[model samples]
Target: MTISDILRDSDYSLDLLEKHIDDLTIFQKEQKSGLTPPYTVCKVRKKEIKLTPEEVVRQLYLIKLHKEYGYPYERMQLEFAVHFGREVKRADIVIMDKIQPTVPYIIIEVKKPKLKDGKDQLKSYCNSTGATMAIWTNGKEIVYYHRKDPNYFEPIPNIPSQNQSLKDILTERVSIDDLIKIDILKTQRRSLKNIILDMEDEVLANAGVDVFEEVFKLVFIKLFDELQNTRKLSTHLEFRNYGESDSELKVKIEEIFAKAKKQWGGIFNDDEKIRLTPSHLSVCVSSLQDVKLFNSNLDVIDDAFEYLVNKTSKGEKGQYFTPRYVIDMCVKMLNPQEEETMIDTASGSCGFPIHTVFEVWRKIYKDLGIEESHLFTAEKKHERALEYVREKVFGIDFDDKSVRVSRMLNIIAGDGHTNVLNLNSLDFSRWEETTKDESWQDIYFDGWRRLKKLRSDKNSDKSYEFDIVMANPPFAGDIKESRILHQYELGKNASGKFQTKVGRDILFIERNLEMLKSGGRMAVVLPQGRFNNSSDKYIRDFIATKCRILAVVGLHGNVFKPHTGTKTSVLFVQKWDEKLCPKKDDYPIFFATMQKSSKDNSGDKIYVKNSDGSNRLDSHDHLIVEHDLYNHDGITQDGIAEAFLEFAKKEGLSFASGKCESPFDEAKYKALLDGLEVIEINFSEVLIDKNIRFEAEFYNSKIGLSDNFLYGDDIIDFV
Candidate 1:
């Protein structure tokens, strides 16, 4: 039977994808087959692939290639094999030249996102087969590239159609305007990151300017060019030839750079020239000019920025970008709504703040009556949606380079910059010079004025303005400089004597709390030592005395990856308000411990795959990579976020199940059982209490696994 026919029970989850692939269609009829067990035929090789979820994705991509791109059947081969270093591996699909059957034209990866080296994987396949193009897709996202040379893969906005030649694609007219029209459906179809990395290897090494500064300037010019050409798709950033001379392209790029600087003054100097030689500049412009940077999902931009910054400032400065997955979990659980102010004190690349802007934008869009289906991709909504970002969110950082990067990211998300200041948030006294400088008046003064209203007092000690705050401060450093140390209450003895030293995060805990007004909620990442160390009893006491602790979730040691192995937890707190805090005698708080850390001990990310060893994909036809304390792809019952939500309902915890003592539907979900005797002994708490007496806490924690529970259809509905 076909998968649709076998799915009569409706027991299986149809979509593990958090995002959708709206651009492509997969016909149910095309997916069904007449084999004995019902397998689908590959359009390329005419071979039967078993009708599993992963195979279904492969078939759809193949159809897109044939119908949309007009790839000839004779040119294609399925299960194409290629050598990877010493080992030989078979790829999903490979397209060959009809004239030269031995020569591979394109290599396609239809495997779910689990294929770690998407670019490198395709590169090796090309090295073996001599394919000129590589495409990777999990159905949610697709990456297209031209294997420019053995060492580089250039990002092409779109691949050529059946009739178009490789030369035509390389030399086609490309405009900044074509990139501004946001196509929401193409969320996963982007990648110039590897291409930029390739550029570094190819020409940037010998470029006269700093690699980061030059590339950043080029990107800035490209973005501004698009902004100026908004909604006008016919305008082009094209050059006459791919093999242009250095001097000619230099003049043109310099003109663009000068204009971009004039338009956006703060980032670049007016006299800043295109440090790249004309030939190199022409190649970069041709490679990047066609792609829409703003339309790409924030993840793509984030990845590129991470690569650039890691090569330069972040590593030496003790700054690391917070993984987007962790940021998503915190945002989801907290659920920031429209009009509520949010800030990130540490704000490394401003991940917390930028995402907050997105969440708020989403809420405000729904409030203004935009359909959820069209929200992300709709160009009409971009300006309307970004207003909350400019008005409500804020950030501060100690590093100037980090501040510049943070501002640029915010500028993209907001479509303009807001209040991302270059200052030491902990050293509030030094903040005056930063805020008062004449050079920073336009960028700083207005936002500073607005932020100043948030302060509880004139002195920087009490700025209780923001309603919500989220931060992952630098953990590897301490405040040895007693000058900055004296600003915090943590820096003093009981008699008010200055302490010699203190943990930087300890001071930040106090600083972040001060930034919040009464009843404002905040989430911060702190070391495990704060929670368990007897030596730090005062820190815990300080937290208890200042705020009502909401929830504490232990994070995997690998969350910060290749950076630090320190065990950390996210502590959610709401500052004391007269109603929710001061008057409360006692309240039960939610407690959780993360079970499945989707990462290995070595800090390498682990992905969810199938029993057959193929990577598992979500409903979006994209690979569902799990990186948090839980898995959220809907393929596993391992989500700690979902578990906590369920627990909140049961325990009548605040913010989850309406009010503190509300009733819970304990039997929300029930596991399916096959033909077996059903005792239903777990139905009663009294019967469970008797068995619980003999069970150790650790033993009970594994209840859903082996002994005392059936092998299949284990504990369901929290019974």
Candidate 2:
């Protein structure tokens, strides 16, 4: 039997254990009549023991202590005991001091697979035994901490080896290259969400402070600390705790936070201070110091902020941060150009607009022949990308907390300015009231001014001329106000009477359409029932009359789990124009259903794995989620987005290929002017009697109907 067999039922992996496997003795004992053979191992104890899941991890760690860390076997002890008050507890493993062989130098806890549980146990043992350092792992994630005092156990990158001092590890200088290579999120196989959860369990849960505000402050300060040393290759990150007193660390962090507020204005109050207690803040900084929050897409920070914001006001409105994979797919299918302007009306954390900036940056880099390194998204190296973000990207959200998060991300993308507004998008009639508020004007005035320049009419907020619109509006609530209902054509029925109430998403559908200029494209996430329900025919007809349906992609049910289980589909459409869309009544539309869920029912992400069951990393060393939405930068199989691009090219969609000035060759044009015979026929009469369906899945389900089949072609003989 192998170590994998012992860890089959646990969440832990064998990746860290594999290298030390040969140093230990692992064998299967003889099986009885009804019992399976148990894996046995002999290590630090020099005695045979049945290797349970926990024992397997402990044994692997012991080998690592001896071989990798240069710790001698004589210095290590298994099941070392210590007295706590009147009770005696045993630590899983302990490394004794070099000079004082009886003193505990490092205590490793392996019984608990979870970080919170293991960390608590380690803290208790360290306090009781006066151990200077501690280690905790479940074979998957490992953490090293130094016991600064009785109340605080600060996180360290790694424990010092046998010959090195803890000061060497604490004072080591690192660059952006080193940070990218050893990002805790990748090396520890832990997400920002998981780390936050650990911090909550350790301190924030009982810190007597607002969890959201305190954590946001820490993350904001840490991001600023990372940005400071991005260009300087030899500077040490100031976010960490390096033998400083708790009070001193807090002062240093608050100073950095103040600088961050000055650098990225509008997210926090000018007088705001980190409210966490000095000791509490010290532990939080240590927990977050090693994380590299900036990446190729800022997805690490995005995922964490999504959780924090959703816990407060977002869930009540049925809003969840759109998954980055889903955002990438939407951005890919839209094919937004650098010159085009884009906006997300709902704008939860501004996922759509921020990703659109990244997409445009890719194109700009390709044109300029600039090679992107691991710091491509983190560093502000391109002036044109920054200008595109500052000028062309905009977002609006009704939730104040979400708007702050969105604004922060947008500011990071643009380096200073942000166009993410905090006004309600559906209630545009009252936008003037919001604009007049001096407090709102102080932060959002620049963005609001830029947004006003794109309006189709200077005096109205009813229409806009943006080139692209993408949003996932709240679907669980209804707009009961008549004033909001009376503003949209969709709000009124066929009888021209405004409804008393309308689904929030329905109003957003109309609002999104109005935001786009003629020939502009949009992608909106809506309930799947809107596409297939017979009672929603008028809504479908309303869309058909105004724009050509480009595509409909049905998402998996678990895509928004833990917060919601609503089955949703993204509707892609392009407005009619004389040159670009031409009001086509009969056209082929692309249809697809995502096969991979990308997440489990518990809302945890499922990552792509290697052949040996370890998670796969991309060229940037970030874990790739298993999905069929799009081939993530060519890391996974070609998915639905790739197929749609091919179909778009074949159909010569205006966005895919430039609009043709003439429909005929020069010879054909000359012949037509020279009295060549021309045939004219009215084909509407043939199609007028047949029933038509606008739902993409309806056509997708029919047999022998290819992706390129024209509307009404099956019912009429076009030849």
**Lowest lDDT block of 10, candidate 1:** 669-678
Top candidate (TM-score): 2
lDDT of 1 by residue, 1-719 (tens): 44445333332222323222243233333424533544556666565555655566666666667777888777777777787678888878887876788777888886635334566678778877778888876554565677767765655555677788777765665454334332212344335565576566556876766877877877777666555554353266532234345477677667777876665556665677777766567557655665555542355456567667777767665567877777866765665766578889999788898877766666666666765431142233456576667667888888776777777767766655567887788888777777778887765675677677777886763576788899988776678898877777777754566789888888889999989878788889887777665466567667777887766776767776665677777888778887534534355454455545656777555657675333565553334456434345456544445444554455443345422223444553112111111112221221122234322122114222222323122221111
> What is the overall TM-score of model 1 with all chains considered together?
0.69
Report the C-alpha lDDT of model 2 over 424-537, residue by residue, as the tens digit: 999999999999999999999999999999999999999999999999999888888988888888888756788898889998999999999999999999987787554566
**Angstrom error at residue 413, model 1:** 1.9
Model 1 superposed RMSD (Cα): 9.7
What candidate 1 gets wrong by more than 4 Å, as runs, is: 1-163, 173-193, 225-259, 286-292, 295-297, 372-387, 459-461, 493-497, 583-585, 600-623, 627-719
**lDDT value, residue 669 of candidate 2:** 28
Candidate 2 root-mean-square deviation in Å: 7.1
What TM-score does each of the candidates earn? 0.69, 0.90
Residue clash pairs of candidate 1: 16-619, 17-619, 113-623, 138-621, 139-621, 140-621, 140-622, 141-188
* 355: Cα error in model 1, Å: 1.3
lDDT of 1: 0.62
